[model samples]
Target: MPQTEIQILNHLPVELLSARTEDLCDILGGPTVINLGGKRPRPLVASSLLHGNEHAGFYAVQRFLQMNIGELPRSLIWFIGNVEAAKASRRRLEHQPDYNRIWTEGPRPENKMAMKLKQFIKEQRPFAAIDIHNNTGKNPHFVNVNVLEKKFLFLAHLFSEHIVYFTEPKEIFANAISEICPSVTLECGIVGDESGVDHAYQYLNAIMHLPEIYSLTETDDIHFYESVARMMVPPDTEILWEDQAPTNPNYIQLSRQIEEDNFKDVAKGSPIATFGGDGRILVMNQKSKELTDDYLSYSGNQIQLSTDSVPSMLTSDLRVIRQDCLGYLMVRRRLEI
Candidate 1:
């Protein structure tokens, strides 16, 4: 079967702007790239809903455009991705590849749409790029970048002072777009938080008028962390949380408040989770090495932190945990400036 190409529109589907995120599929039919002209020629490419369950970006972008109407300060190429997954409120369908990860150079059908979207932004010579998202866990608003460059750091600081620089997930949209322009991913807290929507809307409005992104100066108050490892769970291991404990040996039992550990300066020997049997939580570095014991202490059926560092994106959602990751382990680092 031939893959679906992204739908390209030169103007906003203003009539469908009010459509709920889940209902976008019926209108857009699939992934879409909308290019709207502004006072400036070079566009600012902003993408949203790469993960269908993340709706803050979608709504924020829509609201920002609606408010601007015909007074945009800069051209924009906003790609609304994963509408199919949005229809069912899933991150991605079982048979579908992650939309965000497909933007890297690849030959998959989804990558075709991503590459097409990339081509659109590349043609615009965008001054900056932003991919908006919402966490499934209790996480403060923050930004993520793939590079340690000043422009990327400053671009991220515009959204939040808490910035994470990661290189391992090199194929994600932000990472790929960084090569073309300064790019950052906005983690706008969790879904259904209006503050997140407000922040994202404010961000969109600010970026529409940005002059030169590369020279923007931010404060020394920024909190920077380098993502060094990913935390994962075995596929067959069942997750038990929120007052539920393992009745079987295949389950990993954790506190419902495990997500509260996100962004905290966790001390060594901090409890993470308890295994049902002899199994352990998996922690892997950027090279995909299994250094679980180096980062975690697992004995007596409990998993504890062996390193003093900050953890981010900790989620209790079992599907997200299995599909993507339990969370990421990060270490504090300073940019040379």
Candidate 2:
């Protein structure tokens, strides 16, 4: 079958127009803020498909423009990031590598596609960039606000209940987008849930009209890291976390060690957390905000504990961190071919 790329904006459906690296730069032209009359003032912008499969929000944005039409908030601008991925219904560029994992060095302005987006953002320095995606499963609706930036807390405070930080900080502040903008990544609840889609659509509506409902505030007193923690997993090992672990607003895990039965005590590489099943093992991975700090020890049995540094988002190797460091954090995949 011939592949079709879909770029739907507002209620009007546009055929996926292939961008010459130059044309894409034009499309990524930053936020076009419109000001409608309101007692308070704020800018709300939304974009989706930083990764392809996590496409629920893109549809939500589409539904939003359809229903609201001329009624959309004056200051709100709806955006679509991975025009290429969304068009193909896949995650990243097929021939090209994942975009989300890259951000260390800026995308070459001369590069066909990246330059287009670079120019767009350069032209429109939005107040915030609300990227949307789906979580791995059907869990409670959640939001990821990269914690390093102070502006992220505003989102946590504004949304309160649904916020989930990707860091060890127990507070609502630790989100990947926190550094980039007062941004939020809406995990609109399991990818396939239509209700999740509907609910997210409502939230999008609420955000566009944010100034109407909540008072706006700003602060610069926030914690950001120069160096990041990296996770280096040895071969043949799997890792998992409790779903509720990130539920707390201020919870941070410093060091975690896994106790598995695969290794022997008398010999090398003792078991840490067992992989799969009951009583298999216990595990622990250290979580520390400051990279220079030492991990606190738990006074129990010795498990196979390793402290993996948090990967830098700015690396050529995208495997280091879980969140998008630059641009919009997206699902890590491709749609082309």
> Quick one: best TM-score, which candidate?
1
Please give, for residues 150-191, the per-residue lDDT of candidate 1 as tens digits: 888878888998988888767789988888999999999998
Candidate 1 TM-score versus the reference? 0.92
Candidate 2, 1-337: lDDT as tens digits: 1112222233332321223212332454421222232223344656555556566766776676667655556445454555455445556655644545433234432133333433443344445656667644224555565543445546544443434344433222113234435676666655567876787788777667655333224433322122223223232223334222333332222122211211111122322222322111222222422322231122232333233221112221223213321111112111111
Q: What's each prediction's TM-score?
A: 0.92, 0.51
lDDT, candidates in the order shown: 0.85, 0.41
Off by over 4 Å in 1: 1-3, 214-219, 236-238, 241-245, 299-301
Q: How does candidate 2 score on lDDT?
A: 0.41
